[model samples]
Target: MASIETVTLEVADPTAADRFHTAAFGLGGQVRLRASEAPTTGFRGFTLSLVVSQPADVDSLVGTAVDAGATTLKPATRSLWGYGGVVQAPDGTIWQVASSSKKDTGPATRRIDEIVLLLGVEDVKASRQFYVDRGLAVAKGFGGKYVEFATGSGPVKLALYKRRALAKVAGVSPDGTGSHRIVIGGGAGPFTDPDGFAWEAASPALTN
Candidate 1:
């Protein structure tokens, strides 16, 4: 099955982004901060999710992010779905620290187990088809409201959502300007998704 390799954010300041990702989250250079010319920006059509092993990890991550210049949009709280919260990075990137597992599944060393890149698309059906056509399998999904794909053995999770719902989950306005798209590329040949997101074949240097 096709899966997203990595997410590259085109930001104005790569240095701050690098610092934020390192301090706020334990990401080690997987986030490529390319330069961008678009000035007026908003939600950027997506929000990143950090799936942790424990509920306490959610609080720890949220606190760490706040101390690292991230704004707490929502405090860590418990819900039936599990524990989770939202925060905005120094560069305005929305992140949700969450754990679906109710208890420790087993002894694990890693804190974050997965990174789900949730995309806001115009047509959910068309977007789902775009990835399905490109060899991604549907893990689970609603009719047109949302869709989550199966990214077996891949670190990143790819999901589709209505633009407004995506914005609501991140606690931000859906409208935005500039290049507000994520390049879930590097694993497949170069092509543009239905919503204008770009993808390029995986580079040998970036492969982990």
Candidate 2:
């Protein structure tokens, strides 16, 4: 079995891609692409490469339908975490831009390392069971609501919290059923844990 290794996000706008990097994710650096590098179409690059989408030319269409509103974080610059920047798209969509050297370049590769992807759920027990039934192994933590699951892909941590509670953390109430939608590698979809925490999941965007 593979460990949780890489994650990616395919963004539309170059600006919002910047916001997700610096402001929200606290990353620094703008990973420059070389002609030798291969092209990617999903969050895999952003998560693993720590690289942002090209300023202009990219194969994929990077746009968020959630209308999460747009906000700039800082001037893009090079940093230890690859290309670091931030941008808030329409509908208050916040994105952290960064890549990691720990991404898989193979077509159907499995993860070998561990990186915890935090997800908010209303019922930790139910969420745990959901993954467990899917062949994920569950481990209890000191925090009651905290449950760790071994998603064959990697370590996906589900944090249980009430909708209102998570909303408070986001400093806003739940928007709509599909309020925050983000496109990943192939099939774009909206995912909100039981607590209404919205996010997009797919392969890693950039190379390791």
Candidate 3:
């Protein structure tokens, strides 16, 4: 069984990137990927990389994504990274699909190591069942309010909270357009969850 280990996104403007990261949630500083060393390859926001070994059957691994009503960008295929794919999630975000490779990229530990990404959902029970129905085992924690859905590599943590409460957690005003817009490789769209909390998802842009 393949699972997603990391989720990456690309942003053109650095300042806006920081703002989005801040507004989406207070996942900055501690969770933000360092850019000093890599310079050009610095990360933009929180990443939730999936742990999918077989990278080919991406559709099979992205069951939660599918249930979230993601829009497929490119079906499973081989790329410079590995067998992977991209999708425009229903919440207007791009997601990545690939197997972790500890190659010339340096030791995985050297890379940002921490739980950086958390999917904010409206209904915890429904989301939990959705992932479980797709064969993902829910790992409860934080007194069951928080959960880590197990995948082949690691797991994607599902943080349950109301829209207002979640906005506070993300450290955002919950104002503006009241939604997020994600752009990936010239593709863009709007997305949201059951509770009317919108988001942006896109595959990491190509840069080196």
Candidate 4:
């Protein structure tokens, strides 16, 4: 199964960035600090989504994020699809914490089960085809409005969205600043997508 080994973020303050995320989200994602490589602004064009199995987790994560210096984009609420909310992490990356149903995975053994990287692009069809050509199969989608691809059994799920619409979903503006501030490694990578999202070549450690 294909899996995203880890995500790499270029930030001016990698330590602080890592600290904030680790505290707010409790999932392990890596950060790289390169003064010369850091972008002037913050992340845009994408959102990191965490899927839990309980409605209460949606609320808990949102509260945790706010306590960790994240700004609440949307208060936790229930919808027919489930319950969830959005927040902008201290480093300016938006995070979505959600559960698709009301079943509790249980507090004693609960953990985030998935991290979906949703890219906001100008055209979803083009982006979908781009990945299809790179060997990713469509797992699910809604025409060109939104689409998710099979990224193997990796912990990360890759999906595409309409630029402004995705931002609206995250409760942010579509005007992304600086670089996209992300790197999705391990698939047809070392290449940039149509929107300039970076994907690096898989390293030896990731080959297994």
Candidate 5:
């Protein structure tokens, strides 16, 4: 089964991005950063989500991210699905800190249960089939709206969402152009998907 090993965000300053991510989410090797001056604007057509255990954890991560210079796109709020919020990093990457549990069972901690990379594609069904053809197994699907791929033991999970719907979920406009300013490192490698998401061979540093 193909799996996503790491997500590399192309930023203008790797050092600053590293510091921001450390202070904000304290992520491990799953999320990496590299320098790039690629011309991008508005929404990037993708979002990186930090899924936690409960509502408290969601608030904690979102609060920390805001304090670390991230702009809040959506304040932490409860919904039928769960509690979550959206924030844009100083480097312009949108992040969603979320949890399936709406209520807190205990005190908050900075523990993240999962990291999901959600791509906003023009056609979820087409993109899903594209990944399926690339040896990725479907973990979940919802008609032509969304699809998630099984990651097995991989560090990051991959999902697909319609571009307009995803933009609405992130509280942003749908129109965007230029580079995505992000790369996926996975076993599927060295290819660009239907939506132009680039995937490279997983780095030994990340796979290990």
Candidate 6:
């Protein structure tokens, strides 16, 4: 089965982005950085999510990110879905730190359970079919609203959400232009999706 191996974020300063990510999330090799002068504005059509164990973990991660130069879009708060907060990285990428549990079972730690790449697409169903044709199996679906792909042991899980809705969730405007400034390194191939997100063949070094 095809799975995402690594996510490459194109930033103006690779060194700075590397420092920020390492200090903020300690993501290791699953997320990579590349130098680029890509012209991008507004939302950039997606958000990266860090899923943690509990509310305290959410706060911990969010706090660390803010200290690492990330700007908070939404303060961590309880909601129907649990606790979450949104932040924008200095390199112009949006990240959501979230948890499904309202209460903490233990002391907070910076352990992240999952990293999800949520693409904001115009049509969830069409993007879903497009990925399905590319060998990604749907793990869950919510009509035409959302779809998540099975990642197995891959470092990052992939999911789709309507553009406007996703922007609202991330507390950003849906309007964006220029390159997505992100690339998916996976088993899929060197193809661009309907939403213009690029994908490349996975590199063995990315897992090393």
Q: Model 1: how far is 95 from its true place, Å?
A: 0.7
TM-score of 6: 0.97
Q: State which candidate, 1 or 2, has the greater TM-score.
A: 1
Q: Write the per-residue lDDT of candidate 3 for residues 1-208, one digit (tens) a residue.
A: 3233323333344454445444332233322221222222211222243434454334344443454455555565655666555544333334554454323233222122233245555456776665565455665545334556554343233334343444443334433333222211111113334443333342332221
Each model's TM-score?
A: 0.89, 0.40, 0.37, 0.88, 0.97, 0.97
Candidate 4, which segments miss by more than 4 Å at Cα? 1-3, 29-43, 103-110, 204-208
* Model 3 poorest ten-residue lDDT run: 180-189
Per-residue alpha-carbon lDDT of candidate 6 for residues 77-163, written as tens digits (9 for 90 to 100): 999999999999999999999999999999998899999999999999999999999999999999999999998888899999999
TM-score-better candidate, 1 vs 4: 1
For residues 48-90, what per-residue lDDT tens digits would candidate 4 score against the true structure? 8988888877877788789989998888788789888999877
> Of the candidates numbered 1 and 3, which has the greater TM-score value?
1
lDDT of all predictions:
0.80, 0.35, 0.40, 0.77, 0.93, 0.93
| Model 5, TM vs. native | 0.97
RMSD in order of candidates: 2.5, 13.0, 16.1, 2.9, 1.4, 1.1
Winner by TM-score between candidate 6 and candidate 2: 6
lDDT of 4: 0.77
Clashing pairs in 4: 2-152, 3-154, 190-200
Candidate 1: C-alpha lDDT: 0.80
Looking at candidate 5, the ten consecutive residues that score lowest on lDDT are: 199-208
